[model samples]
Target: MTAAIRLATARVGDLAAVMRVMDAAFEPAYGEAWSGAQLLTLFALPSARVCLAWDGEQVCGFSAARIAGPESELLLLAVDPRFRGRGIGALLMKDWQAWAAGEGADDYFLEMRADNDAVHLYEQSGFSECGRRPAYYRGNDGMVRDAITMRRSRDRDGED
Candidate 1:
């Protein structure tokens, strides 16, 4: 039997699950250096929108966004290590896009470390590189790193 895939809203109680997925998907080299407390702050942000993918009791993947004015910025996306290759990331992204569209967002954006392989994922989701911030990220290597900014806009006909 195939495992059921479910999407649900994330709650204050789900911070630990979200952190678990993030820590597993992003090692010290990739994550934002955010402690658990910092992540909790994200849960508290007024503009925050978070969603999680579940396979029964396990959290398979998650995504978050923060909307400001006309732009919705994807803040985090991670799939559990055990469930990485089954299109869970894409599922989470689709959910996020739906939420942003419901919020009347006209544009969506995200920033990733220049070396992050997930840039390809964003591209596959229709985001295009619009700008870059050099030396924008502080790496574990004790050097600054660049970040690539990507964007996707809603068509005037209201399509992504």
Candidate 2:
């Protein structure tokens, strides 16, 4: 049976998968910088919401966000390498955006390495580069990389 992609509220049981994808996606860039405990805290935070794309028991993609004080932040998003370019990332993002808007967020923010290829996807989804942080990420070899901060607005009253 083929697993369908859908949206659901994240639960404590999802922590293992969340850690897996986050480390898989950021390992090259963050070099084990984030521990599972840290990820658990983020996932368990009241302001943060998570959505996962699953293929049966396996998680193919995931997106996480934090919404509070009229602002939201996309903390993580990733598609399994085998599932990239299949619109799964977009689906996860859309789910997060909808949830953010419903929670009273007027805008969303995300930060990624300037060189990350996924930056284009975020841009295509209407995110705009708002600023940059120098030496924001610690690479595998101990080198620091620049990060670009992006933002997207959902309009007053949450239109579009």
Candidate 3:
């Protein structure tokens, strides 16, 4: 966070760097970090887009989304643990929305662990809880966790 961070559209070649960020951002106890093969498959999808936040040559954070019709679903968002609390996560969210808007998205949605503390951050970003799925994830501790779906309506005019 000491150095200024810049957001950029991530290229296919950046997959490894983005996966590294995902690994560093998610804890094993949470069982939420995505595998490289999974990410590689997503990158190959035409509906998917990946964006990266860079501090010099290093990727501090990244976000990915799937766009279909007028709807966009945030598939993943992560910031390196060391870079957290520095506003990188919020930046990634904003960038993701902007990109979605430019792609003609009018409805944005995302789902995450119900107990995730980041819920407040999403609320502040204009998302509202729209639905929930019970026992959607089984954590490493062998406890089941619920998933909450949050959504935000974007104007077709494209204003963030």
Candidate 4:
């Protein structure tokens, strides 16, 4: 029988596999991929956590985030190209918010390039743009892209 796909909390031991997922998910021409060292350092931080969706030994997707005080920020979310449009990214987003909410986070935020196709997914997940950074991201082709900051409110009073 084949092992079923499942989501799990990522650990240091999973770094290599996680990086493979990241590399496969991102388009290298965009220069948005994070190196293994960067991911290792981020995961090693006290406030950061990663959630991985795995199919047996293969990493299908992952979401990394940081929680500080009453707020939490999604640092990165990626799913292998072969897994796109299969609801993997949405599951990761929901998991990130749910995990942070359980930890007393009242506001969840994420920053992404304005042209990202995932913006619709984020909006569908209850996020709204709260800020913007002009020309914040530069691609390998020398073009700059705007960055948008989105927030999801977990409190009834709309306060973070």
Candidate 5:
């Protein structure tokens, strides 16, 4: 199943498909999903990049990031629930890091709800916990969750 998945640069026409994947991937209680308009705003940024993963004709995953000088932030990443565990998330992370590096980014950052299991995937991709905000995310159910910030520095001749 993983073999059939392909990653490509996201096009404006792919917005709807990306939204569908976002809807399926994010649990409503977490209030983590971004609106289509918000995503479109990212598309207008010169430094922003969005990648989409497709399985046949279906959009299964996506990742969005933006770079500023030597720093880059991963704004969003999601894989459809039906496509989880097939390495799509890892693929997205790898692609984002490469894209950022190519765009002159040396430090990469991402923040997520502390309880998110995707932390494991980010860690595997070389991101480590760098900071945290207590009770940062207020969920739809009025429950708060910590937001953890993770960072990965490109190894420049063994120096981070």
Candidate 6:
């Protein structure tokens, strides 16, 4: 039987696990994986938060985000390739949103390469395309990709 997955708030010590997941989930050609130092910087920020998903003692996924004033942006979200299709991404999305809400964020945003398959995942989580930046990312393969920005608002009652 496989181990049950669980989510937890990530601490500085979980950096290694986060890196492991990021390395396994992100393609090197995309050049999207962040370094341990970068993650540590985020961890130091009072406005940022990180959540990790664990399968037994192993970290299977992680989501990082930050809240600024009334806005929250998802900095990164990754699930180990071996653990995809098991709803880990969706779970992390939910945790990110919940953390943002608790932080009093009225809007949530995320940006990713235009061709990223996670677009569907964000859409299913209530995020919609809001903007785009042409040639925003130059991958390791020497190819440039557009960046797609997505947003989700907490004012769902039409009472803004």
For lDDT, the strongest prediction is: 5
Better of 1 and 5 by lDDT: 5
Worst 10 residues of 6 by lDDT: 151-160
Judge candidate 6 at residue 24 and give its lDDT: 94
State TM-scores per candidate. Answer: 0.91, 0.88, 0.93, 0.91, 0.95, 0.94
Residue pairs in candidate 4 whose N, alpha carbon or C atoms collide under 3 angstroms: none
Give lDDT tens digits, candidate 1, residues 2-35. 2477999898899888878888888785447356
Residues 16-110 of candidate 6 have per-residue lDDT tens digits of: 98999999999999999999999999989999999999988899999999999999999999999999988889898988988898888889999
Q: In candidate 3, residue 17 scores what lDDT?
A: 96
Off by over 4 Å in 4: 1-4, 155-160
lDDT of 3 by residue, 1-160 (tens): 4359998878879988998898888878889988888888777888888889998889999998999999999998998988889888888888888888888888999999999988988998999999999999998888899999999998546677
Quote model 1's TM-score: 0.91
Q: Pick the winner on TM-score between candidates 4 and 6.
A: 6
Runs in model 5 lying further than 4 Å from the true structure: 158-160
lDDT of 4 by residue, 1-160 (tens): 1136678899999998889898898887679888888889876788888999876767899999999999999999999997777788888888888888878899899999999998999999989999999999999978899999999889686432
> lDDT for each of the candidates?
0.83, 0.79, 0.88, 0.87, 0.92, 0.92
Give the candidate number with the greatest TM-score.
5
The better candidate by TM-score, 1 or 6, is 6
Write down the worst ten-residue block by lDDT for model 2. Answer: 26-35
Q: Which stretches of candidate 1 lie over 4 Å from their true place?
A: 1-3, 31-33
Clashing pairs in 3: none
The TM-score that candidate 3 achieves is 0.93
Candidate 5 lDDT, 83-125, residue by residue in tens: 8999999899988988988888999999999999998998998
Clashing pairs in 2: none
Error in Å for residue 90 of model 4: 1.0
